[model samples]
Target: MKQNLLLFSIGIWLFSCQPGAETGSTQISEESIKTHIEVLSSDDFQGRKPFTEGEIKTVNYLVDRFKQYGLEPGNGDSYIQEVPLVELTAMPSETMTIEGNGQKVELKVLEDFVAYTEKVVEKTSLNSSELVFAGYGVVAPEYNWNDYEGLDVKGKTVVVLVNDPGFASGDSTFFKGETMTYYGRWTYKYEEAARQGAAGCLIIHETVPAGYGWSVVRNSWSGASLYLDQTGGSYQPDVLGWITRDAAIKIFEASKVDMKNYAVKSRSEDFNALSLGLSASVTVSNEINRDKSQNVIAKIAGSEAPEEYVIYSAHWDHLGIGQEIDGDSIYNGAHDNASGIATMLGIAEAIANMEKPKRTVVFLAVTAEEQGLLGSKHYAQNPVYRPAKSVANINMDGITAWGPMKDLTVVGYGQSELEDIAEDIAKGQGRYIIPDPEPGKGYFFRSDHFQFAKVGIPALYASGGYEHMTKGVDYVDSLNKVYLTSQYHRPQDEYNPETWTFDGMKLDGELLMEVGMRVANSAEWPTWKEGSEFKSIRENSMK
Candidate 1:
């Protein structure tokens, strides 16, 4: 999308008032970004997972940095914001019993299936629960689709597909086509099942739609699962899990149901729920621990309108020590988010060193984002700076490592006016703004920025890795492929000084600093674009 030159001119004049501010961005150098990433992604931090020693180390490091930089604690004299959470480590039966229609099959745990529950209890189980095939498990009224319109799954188990109906339907008008909406997310499916009073919800996982392999599911679900302490009696399914496509096919065959036919029918709006004529029984013993994780928040107070704010956010958590693979166990989230945290820190330091903007500028390092964006979600619900006062949120999830690129990949592009600002910044740096290369992967909703977006705060999540400065797009793609194939969410994602470069991150950090500074200084607030789902949210909240 081309930026309106008129808005670009206005933005230029708006931010040009910050005297010597361009030099502030230059202070975000490669050395600073590399130092932060190296320390955060090191094995000594133990993966930076919440509710562990890693959490303590990670949060303390952030707090210490903020103090050293002479920034104020964002949370009322305390840099730490406690996010209450419950960790449930489930020991499920080795096999799940699936039987009916004179046939029976045992689904192996961590192989054919992976299951766990978030209901903070010592034990939760589904006993002989009748199985029902629920298409997508969505009830999006705006789309006029309800997979459970006339079905009652109370005390039963639901079998839903990985993505929404538009996964491969190629109908752009339908559910945003291949770009997965919140309805397509597995988190949404489990929430919908619990809303329908179902005892269990199992999403059938396939590589393309689920966006990862079964190994990811096995490793993620094998460890202790964390949930924002649902102390107010919010209900969750007794059994929430995923079954490999092969396992789902096997179970469907045993129930005498044609899996292919059901999958085909599920893509249509007229499709209805069908009972699989099978009963699923699984028992899981849970070890529950209620704990608190810290969200490190530090701020540079405004020289003028201090109540209004511009925010920078990044999640500081990753999969702790997990299923050992390739003779390694630590899931050092270098690219997954250590890079993001590093970038945010670099930007924060640069901005703090310069003259303050009109509105406060905050840097937030949140916890449990890998768990499910829980820390940001909690902060959004209980905020020190109200959403209405927040001018914008600039989030960094992962930074490019294959050197600077010509294209700035904006995740969730066209959602808000923040993209327009990003466009101006990118053009100034001899780069162009482009939409996410893999929008179907739902990178926007997968990050902590979505939490801020949900509450009407315009957020920017953009990076430059699509078209490398010297090597071009194909070279960047190859490196990205290698990381996704081997190191993504795995132990191999460690800092290798010989291979990793911080020049690109330095490029991004500088631009991100300008984005926040512009928003903080400008009197005009950014808003969700006309067709965005979040438009009405800001409208209702401001009222």
Candidate 2:
């Protein structure tokens, strides 16, 4: 009864939300978003990394809030879903040796190169595997493009570019132009290499094309990584790694191959693999720790139709602590995901106080997203609810940390019908919708929503755009550049009550809240758009 009174008071406190969607209630407040960010990003939480005491604090906080908001447990009277994961800390030798053509080049680990293997083995090695430049390492039959058309890469180490040819060619008709498909992602490159029976794969990391600096590569791969337990079967290559652009250039020079000339040729349809005639050798030993992480789930059961559901998600993990900079060793991830989780929490608090919808609404705080979407992948494969009953997914990765924005940027624009719904609501708030300016980053595929989309659930991952209301576009761009270069994946992501603002995050929260609420109330389901690669998957699931 006391909790009911508090919930009633909460409903009374939050009045007059956005228009056209039950404007009488459920306000997502900036103060609310701020508090969550501050608490989660504080040093006390210890970066919220999985498999740590920090996880306990984070999970308990979420559960307490859910109970206070009067939400029901999503998974059979339990709020926690145990996701099995294996943490592997790969320790490679100090030097990666490349020898051929009377030339020997040694690349230092974490400086000129970084390597790790996902295979569940005590030790793995590349014993002088022949090096092959396999272009972008893409095999898209739909586009008549195959970088490994003729040559065999079995037992060889294939060196590939970062993004696909679309970014290089700038031809809209060819491979979706500057926008990156699944083909451009580093994950795809590694996966394709393993499929071709390659012993190792090393991606040439270019700052611009790869969308982040080499520091990001160094920071992310320099630590223990979490993968779904691979006890059943595994196809991961023995050696998966990255080489600095300078390192790649040196190797090219040693191989007598013109790096510039080959880079240009790789963008064309007729491009083929080039045997650099060089051989690479590196050995990596793994320290594997297998455990389970929790996915916090709570739901507001639908009053009318409880069978159908609408899902909202945010990742709850980040780089815990490493590579101290500026006298800070803690990676707080304030804007990276604390803002996202805060916004989602705000939405949850709002909706929990409101009347239930026609479809069950689930709030999922997934774990280990920083480790290549592993938590969400486990959820997709081992789902609590069937994909067929899932209406749509509204995802918040990193919400706006600044003040209000005039535009909301859809990461994968035109991929799903969710963008259309969001655009209409955004316009009502005097805000516009735009596509992601930096499509080469593959931001869409980087988030947890991509896992849902993989299983044919239409997902939306939109956030604050480059156009801020008070600040201009250039100001937003400059701020983003600084964050990407310095703070991203670094220990400087702590929350600052003095500088960081949450008005834009509040706006985004309210916008997506309405989207989820509307979908929950309606019987109709949103879907993938035409030309989207996931369209057929959704169609098959629906059928």
Candidate 3:
């Protein structure tokens, strides 16, 4: 009953905000952010890999800290939300082979492409099934395009090229112009193929088109892949993987087709799935395991509208012990996500020390984000509060350890009114907002915010700026380019305060707090932009 009254009181407080005056300035301290980052990025955590001992240690630490700050459990009586996961590693029978019209080509997994099975079976295979070259493998009724039009893809392997045609054509008018929509993502392609009853799926990889090289895809997917246990979920393709362009050319030539013409024809809207006139056969054996992960949740209830909430999220998992490089076996993820988790905890501390918000606020440290956004997906599918009552999601993915930049880069910038709120808060501190330069990378769909977006919640996953002050923008860009190439997802990602700038991270945390706090105190809920695919969902949920 006390909790019920407190929630009702917070609702009352929102109407009492003094009009025509700047609400009192938030007092977020730099010392708090510094302290949180220091401990999270420390070596004792062993990179906080989910399903490992590190995860237990990390969750205990966060929950203990939340207690110290007087925060309540987000879920009744507990601070953890259990996320069930199953890890399956796909091992091919041998090398995957392609044969068509008296010609044969052999491709090795991990060298030419990385393939994995999503099926729960012990073994699966495809033999002599015809291949179909599906352009992007997208079936958008709204776009009046369907790659599977009149085609029975059952028991057939569908080959697709990465990204949308608009990416290469520089036609923003085609599909949100330069920005990558969900159609451009490889996961969606694979899902669509599986839904279409295709036997197998292979995505053709090009550096620019895929936003990364074949090596990245190989490294990320080659490890143990996790999926939610859907006892009766749609069947996954028998074979799933990617192939190099040269390898794709070999398959095309074997089919007695002009590789150049096939490539050019795929760029047109009228293009449909074509018979590759070849068959791909692969046998995959799986090592399956089941485990339960947890999402650590802490809350600061408001003085008034407790049912309404403002959420802040960060992923706590990183690549576990992997191939050793120079004897550093751990990928500490100090920068990839340790920094992000640290910022989330810091923001929680800052809020805990402030006057009570008008609405409840939740600080969520989710798991399995590195393994395809599992933790956040579960949360979105099973939210603590109805999606309509939640105000917004403020996510911190990769925070800058470099000193503060003059600009803040908002990923998926134009999708939400939250960006306007972010800009308002950023400008208040003499900083400016910038859109991501590499939108074609499909970064918006790559993080935890995407799970929330799928459920019609407005989310913002903004990271540190690559544009530096002392160094030129080009120099900053070069540094990121190098990180993306050598250090990302590699064992080389260790915490080195010497090379990092906490000033920027601290500033970013403050801006995030400001945004969340402002929304929590207001009666308004954010809306998606007009014409956005998610807009209608948000509108319906609000009603």
Candidate 4:
């Protein structure tokens, strides 16, 4: 009787340990996620900075995890995709001299202005370059607006305002009305200036419209900046930078233009680019370094349509060691990305244990995301699986740590059908979907998913909901505000396993798994929404 009882107990334990045995559903292991986060965010990883020892450890760790999960190599016979990058550390002059209307104004670095050069040269100088106030510096034909209309800015410096007219005027008919479009992005301003053959671009930064303080701009752009190698040739402005509102006011005063009047007038479609009658003279010295980073790629090939793929992505790099703050130098990006990578591992493990999917599921851990999404951008441009063959891309960036919530926030909500799928999955999990809380920040274009989206692949980027289960909405709101103000991109973003909660992160991982599984099993290919900016790109790729 004792021997029979022992045998029966052993059998029951084995059954419970099997995947899909618990409640007839396959669940991601919370223990596995905890271990992954603790290890990835540990100080020994040195913040996982690209091209450093930290990056080497991070890539190895991810590759080992993928191998342990029984995933095949995503990039032909290799688990790594090399990303060639050029690191440019610009050392600008102490003072930027601006002369206008028989007056000279010197702007201080870090305090009054922040600037850099992307010219990839040892030394670059702007010797009395003509400065033109280009009013937002946008030329969007769709909006019937062109700030550079009938203006030739070649070899000149263009100064533009941050955000768009809709944000400034709060007019619904302007450009998405308070919700910043791509044109509102600072990157767009620089790119537009470069397209118009400008030698330099400076964005006037207002905290409200720019979404962050001047300190963020200083900290982010002051140090080493990396860009994908464009040895073949790329159009980039000779100088790119930002000026504080005070500095802009000073310049306007020197130029004899009412700064407030010009700001108000810029909102109108009839606004024209005004020559500031100012000349800028500054020298930029660069210390250039070339290195190779990598994107760790793994895959679970489909049994049937092996050519088609569904991608799961997360960036594994952070702002590495920098100027010490409060005796701490390492920016251990725990919530920024360690949580996302942990979630991706959990999903990978769950998928590995399931039956073969009908479409290939690729797990990609990209590098250099903090340095402008370089790894993902390279993959999107030179993909292992063609964009036309990919079903969808689901990216996990920073996941909420404040516990489970009642809703999920979808970034770029209406741009693709992937959101509909994610919405249904969230609904099944007893949660609803909400658009991004801060739409003017353009969070959708700020992640790795944007790279895939640009290549015509429908992508989904969502965050843990704002309404917490126990803490409620007010608590969640306060927590978000605190995080943005105190912890984001700072050395204080360390991992404290004792205080962290994986409940919401786990739920989000499960939802992503469900969406990916459903898309993989179905024959339908997710596409951009009918009127989405990416719709034409998708249609053309499919053709």
Candidate 5:
């Protein structure tokens, strides 16, 4: 009888150890997240920048952490994927001359607009290309509207406005309406121009429609612009740039059309192509140097299905040492992306500690996000895993430094079934999902995940709620205003534990882990929404 009891006890113990048996341990801990953020965003990291000493330290730290977690190197024999980059500083032409209506007007270079060239050659010029007013400069067959239909702009410089007409009207049906569609993006405009064989493309900037002021364009475009080496190998375009609305008005006036009339006409489909009867001449000098950066990648392969993959991404680079502001230097970028990297590391640790997932999970800390999402772009173009087999990319960027919230904000909602998984996870914790309030800003296109979306992978980036507890929307809006005016991209951005509430960071991290866990286990695969442009690409990739 004693022997029989011993056998039964052994059987019970084995049953308790079976896979999927409940263990009431927290998946990820708040302490780990706090420690990571504290260390990463601390004054010591020196604002982790690419192509600098900081980048070396940052990458090494990530690799070490991955090693500690027993994650295998994602790349062959190494965790870093090299990216070729070219830094260009286009010395401004003293003046831009517009000739039309028997009048000559010279516009000041930086005051009127900012322009650059991809031509690596020392000298580049746009010699008297005729100016064509291309309404919004968009060509979409599905929308049955083609801005280039009435005019041939083969060698002409096209002047177009930023964003789409639907933006001004806030009509959801209009070009995907209030939410900026890929059609409304500035990148699309430039690419379309290049594809159309246009000599030049200049978008007129307005704060509201562009979702940012001219200063942002000036500051962002002031530095180097990185492009893929295979992208025409330096024969991309002689001119791709932006001009202020005031300069556009000057051009309109020179064309003998009322500036207000053209502004109003900019919104309507009936707005026809107008020959400004003008020509523009610009001569620019280029300083080009090619360099290479790297993306740090680490992976935890699944046992049941190692081929299938899930990815978590965060940019590992930020603005290096820059001009001093308010007596402080070093655009620390602690909140901008250090928080993201920390969150990514924290999540990786959580997944590593848990029972092995059914599908592989990759942790990608990309570089050059501040330089126009180059690192992620390269990865998407040359993925370690088949993007088709990759289930989804859960991207974290610029996570909240402020405290926790009752809600989580998804940048692109209603665009994927992945959101349903997110909602379920949030609902389990009595949290809710909210669409980005400023959809017009195209927040979806601003981060690393955008590269994944461009190539058909379903990607999601969620941020803590901006709504405040004590002072409500006004207070939150005030803080945002301050960040926009003073901190963003400035040296004033530094980590402040006293001011920032990391509880929100922990909450966000936990929620993301939950979402990733759900996706990692499910036999189901997510897809782009029915009408999304990427749906076909995803479907084809799946096949």
Candidate 6:
């Protein structure tokens, strides 16, 4: 009863404090948000995975809701944008052999290492491919750092570190310090290795620098993976994988090199790729399936400048079914993203009733985010609206379900002026905007907003604050820790309307709605901050 009373009080407070209250244009519905999350996260939705019956149901449901809310189809004549994806499911041999100097070592699949092939071939093999230690596998002209300098790694395996030099050295002068530039991402490492003409790329995973455990790598890479189907094959390594730190240590020891000393030396610009005198052999059989996924898009055209757009995006895909735990196989990603979709729905409904702004507003529910932001990447590459005309992208990945808070946390806080607008609106709600507490984890780069950001559009991604209304900071922190360890990416992430609160999620939806409105109405474009790497990209794009 106490919790119920608190929720009622929050609703009343929000109703009184809403910026649109005086004008009576639109009011957010917390119950509607709760209902959307409940249905989307329910068992019947089959976890809302793409390329299955779940995707059919999910997209149809979104289109129905958008029509009910009177939102026009965002695309020319349809609410769905077809995204062509190729699914690669690698069936590796039980064991992989590493041999060098007349000595052989066998690594168990999914236990010591996890690997897959980007090539869409039935059989992919590596026979005694020489292994070289390429530090971080980065070649950035801006940073003047080249890990593959003077090294020819064609038809060989390049062992790379997970993150960049700045993360290891803790120096502000190198690669954005601990903030994790795009160079630090594992995707970047694989791409760079492929560009260097390497046949295989293996990232050495440490929990601290990788920001995730070995279990994540194992589970995520073990199952069927989706990628945008390339017409004539792209520059991707034949084998991309992650080796546990223990496995890497053993490999280094066998190669007669100290892993710790090499890691330290790799942080410096003068470091060169080391020949490990090792060779790797493996064969992977893949079951390849090609399919078309849809990105649900709905729009409210502008009253005046309808060509200019403000995009609101949230991914609608999750890990469908994989290894089971506690007799449950479904990974019902309620908090991971169902909440985010719910927030999007709430924003869409609210905006539908509001006075049409001068610029267009788009609500996009993208697919295949759980498989490395593929949906957003496709949209960024082939947007329905020209990238230059899109004003900004506001992404909501995982909104808080733990009730109201006194502040909001903005991911990628200082990268764009959109955050300034978010902060101003947050202040109007008696809340302040705070930077992400764990910047080292690189939450900003891990979401859909990053796709838009890469294409020179100012994007904003944020979540509810940690300072809870009823419960204090300590409780909120503990709750977050519990969620991260116990529920994140697991089957336990289900919606429980009896216990879960939508107050915080509703607040975040309101903030996003207000930000979208302000951006849509404004004449000026939001640009990246002065020192941001994306600033020049945005300027060039505008030109």
Highest lDDT against the true fold, candidate: 1
Quote model 5's TM-score. 0.90
Please give each candidate's TM-score: 0.89, 0.87, 0.89, 0.90, 0.90, 0.89
316-341: candidate 6 lDDT, tens digit per residue: 98877766988888888998799899
RMSD to truth, every model: 3.4, 7.3, 6.3, 9.0, 8.5, 6.1
How do the residues 240-320 of candidate 2 rate in per-residue lDDT, one tens digit apiece? 999999999999999977667776899977777899989999999999899999999999998877988899999989878
Rank order (by lDDT, best first):
1, 2, 4, 6, 3, 5
Cα deviation of 135, candidate 1, in Å = 0.8
lDDT of 1 by residue, 1-543 (tens): 444522544444555555533444346868878899999999999999887899899998999999998999999999989999998888998999998999889999999999898887777888999999998899876577899999999999999998888788978788778888778888889888989999999999999998988998998888677888876454678889999999998988887667677667999878989899999999888888888988999999988889998989999999889889999999999898999999998888787778777789999999999888999988998887999888899999989877888988888776888877777778889999888878889888888989998899888889897899988989998998999789988899889899889889988888888788877877777888755657777888888
- Per-residue lDDT, model 1, residue 18, is 52
Candidate 5's clash total is 0
| Candidate 4 lDDT, 1-543, residue by residue in tens | 123211223222332233432222778888888898888888899999998899999999999999998999888899999999999898988889999799999999889988897777888777899999999898876677899989999999999999988886867667777778778888778889999999899999999989988988998888789988876344678888899999999999898665677778888878888888899988888899999999999999998788899999999999888868889999889988999999999999998998888889999999999989899989998898899999899999998877888888898766777777776667778887888878888888899998898789999999775899777899888988888788888888877767688888889999888878877777777777644657777888999
Worst 10 residues of 2 by lDDT: 4-13
Whichever of 2 and 4 has more lDDT, that candidate is 2
- Residue-level lDDT tens digits of model 3 in 1-543: 122211222322342342311235555556665666666656676777878877888899889989998999989989999998888887875577898888888888777767777777778887887889988788775456677888899889999989876676666677676778778888888889989999899999999878887777877777678886554456568778888988888888888665576655776877877788888888888898988999999999977899998889999888877778887887778777888888888788778888888889999989999888989999998898788988889998988777777788888867887777777667777776778878888999999998888788989888557677567588778878878778888777766757866777778888888778778877777777654657767888888
lDDT of 5 by residue, 1-543 (tens): 123211223222332334543323556566666677666655566777777777888888889989998889998779999988777778868888999789898988778877787666667778998888887888876566788886788888989888876676646676677788777889878878776778888999999889988888887766567655453542345787889988988888888765576655866778787678899998878778787888999998887778999899999888878777888667788778888988888889888888888888899999999888989999998999899889889999987766666677888766776666666556656666778888889988899988998888988888666665344566667777888788888877777767877777777888888667766766667778756657777888878
- What lDDT, from 0 to 1, does candidate 1 have? 0.86
Task: Tell me how far the alpha carbon of residue 430 in candidate 4 is from the true structure, in angstroms, after superposition.
Answer: 0.8
Where does the lowest 10-residue lDDT sum fall in candidate 4? 1-10
Query: Candidate 3: which stretches are off by over 4 Å?
Result: 1-23, 99-105, 256-259, 469-475, 478-486, 540-543
Error of 1 at 164 (Å): 1.1
